[model samples]
Target: MSNKHTTLRKPVLLTSLPLGVMSFLLPIYSKKLGMNAVEITGLFSILSLILIITRPIIGKFTDSFGRKPILIVSCILFAASYFIFSIATTSVLIYAARIFQGIATATMTISTYSIISDTTKENNFSKAFGRIHSYKSTGSLYGCIIASIILSFMTFTQGWKMLFLIFSILSIYSVIEVIKNIPESKKIVTVKCDINKNKSRNTMKLLIIVFMTCISSSILGPVFMIYMQDKFTNNILLLAYAFFPALISESLLSKRIGAFSDKCGYRYSMIFGILICAIISIITPSANSILILAILWILSTLGGVLYNVSEKNIYTDMIGESCVGVMYSIYSIVCDFGLMIGPLVGGILYDNVSHQAPFYLSGFFMVIVAILILILIKKDSICRVD
Candidate 1:
């Protein structure tokens, strides 16, 4: 492993922990606060919209002021958001917390991604990202286990509040780690001419691919949890169990899968990943029991990990070395645009149309995205990092 990658692992893991803890429970917590499907998913839409607006600004800052400072700001914002979430009772307060998280996400994702792309070699992209995501998934797994243990002893309200408080403290610690341990990325100047010449058209293609894929994933975002709540046990621990094995497996497999992508080529791995997710999404609504659903969820998550590792590799290939921060933020904007649309439509469809509408739509769209990837992305289309 590279020295820079080694330096980044702990902070990356620290950053992902809070997100993992929040992923399964946030919808339930929002529901407890009187949010319906629309409202619960609307919070995500609001966050994505904020990301679209702020990411470019954060990107510019990342390029100019350096990555470490932006990351520190992002960690502080994450801490603040969790603190607000711990105390929130109203939807307004929830929205406020999500807004803070949105900005944090904008800063955190762009800077971290840029730093990785800047430091890692192009051919090693998948392996490096895989190893990093392994740490991230491990952190998330720990968060899920910890949150489940806390919930096992307390009422839902109390458990969620305590979880957010714990998340806040973790984020604060992450901030200190960033300040003291993480090193700044060295600027890349050698490849500017090549990057400037070829980046535009390929960048557009990548953005479209990302936007559609985001829609595919987010189409069932809040609605899936709502369905689980209605049909299965409302116990958060059970939900955590459904994810626990999957998280462990994904964490363990990330590096191996990344290495596989590096050797076997990105196209087939990405296509297969997308198809697996599509198949699982299509089959999920038909699950008759929690066990069956957990099995399917595990498959879906593994598929997602496959797609994500390859996708990040492709995305890093597209990034201009000289402006990794700004380019990545632009990429994130496209992702958030799709994310903003998918959840709103999914929630509306679930409420007014049918519960299965979002699932089927999500599956169908993923298949289309997979086909698009097969056609649009090619070996020569991807630029190498210098």
Candidate 2:
């Protein structure tokens, strides 16, 4: 491992702990607040919209001011956001909390990602990201287990509130790590000054990949719980059952796939990943039993994991460490923008069309996007850090 990864891994893992718990629980929490399918979907879209609005601004600030400063501030807000989630009773209040959460997340994402780019070896980007994601997945899986125990002990509403409080407290450790242990990214100043002289490829080309893939991937995200609720309910263990297998697979294989990309190239890995995702999404509606559905869901997740990690590698490879905050913020904008739009469309379809329709539409979209972008992205390395 690189010195920087060694330095940053502990704090990153600590920060990721809360996120894991929130991932499986947030939609359920939204439902408990009396949000229906549309309302719940709206919450996700709203979060993404807020992220879209904030990413570029956050990107610019981090790139200009430095990474650790932005990260510390975002962590403080992240802790506060959980407190809001604990107290939220109405949809409006939840929306307010999500906006704050979104901004904090936006900044943290760019800063953290930029830091990885700053510190990791050039050839190790994919492997480094994969390892980081595995750690995050491990954190998420544990969070699921923890969430299950909490839910078993209390009502969903009460358990959720307690979970948020615990999340808030745990976040303090992350804050401390950032302040005391994590180093500021050394590239921030140099990158900020050199962008004008650099002819690294245009942002628009890479953004096309982020935008389309995210939209395809997120189309079913908002409606998934509501769709699954028909087959399973009441037990938080259901969330565990639904997610654990996939999470385990992702954590285990994330590094292998990243290493594979390093050897075979990112383009092929991406095409294969999205192709598998497209196939899985199309067949999800056919799984009449919960067990079968879970299996297919697990497969769907792998495709997404592969695609995401590879794409992150490809983006970092194109941009190098310089201006990464801005580059990734641009990438985040595309992703969140797609995420925002997908739910609104999915919400409309879930209510008007069949619940399964959005999944099918999403799958088809990925197939087209994969084929199109395959043609657009060049085979040559667009920019070389070395």
The prediction achieving the highest lDDT against the true structure is 1
Local accuracy by lDDT, each model: 0.82, 0.75
Worst 10 residues of 1 by lDDT: 377-386
Please give, for residues 1-386, the per-residue lDDT of candidate 1 as tens digits: 37777777766776677678776678778998888988886776677789999998998899878899998998899889989999999999999999999998889888888788877877788888888888888988877777768888999899888988888888899888888878888484765434355457766887798899998899887688778888787786677677677889888898888877777677777888999999998988889998898788778988888788888898788664767777777788888888878887888989999999899999999999999898888853243333
lDDT tens string, model 2, 54-122? Answer: 888888888778889998887777778877888899988788778778887887788878887887776
Instruction: Assess candidate 1 and give its TM-score to the true structure.
Output: 0.89
Assess candidate 1 and give its lDDT.
0.82
What TM-score would every model get versus the actual structure? 0.89, 0.88
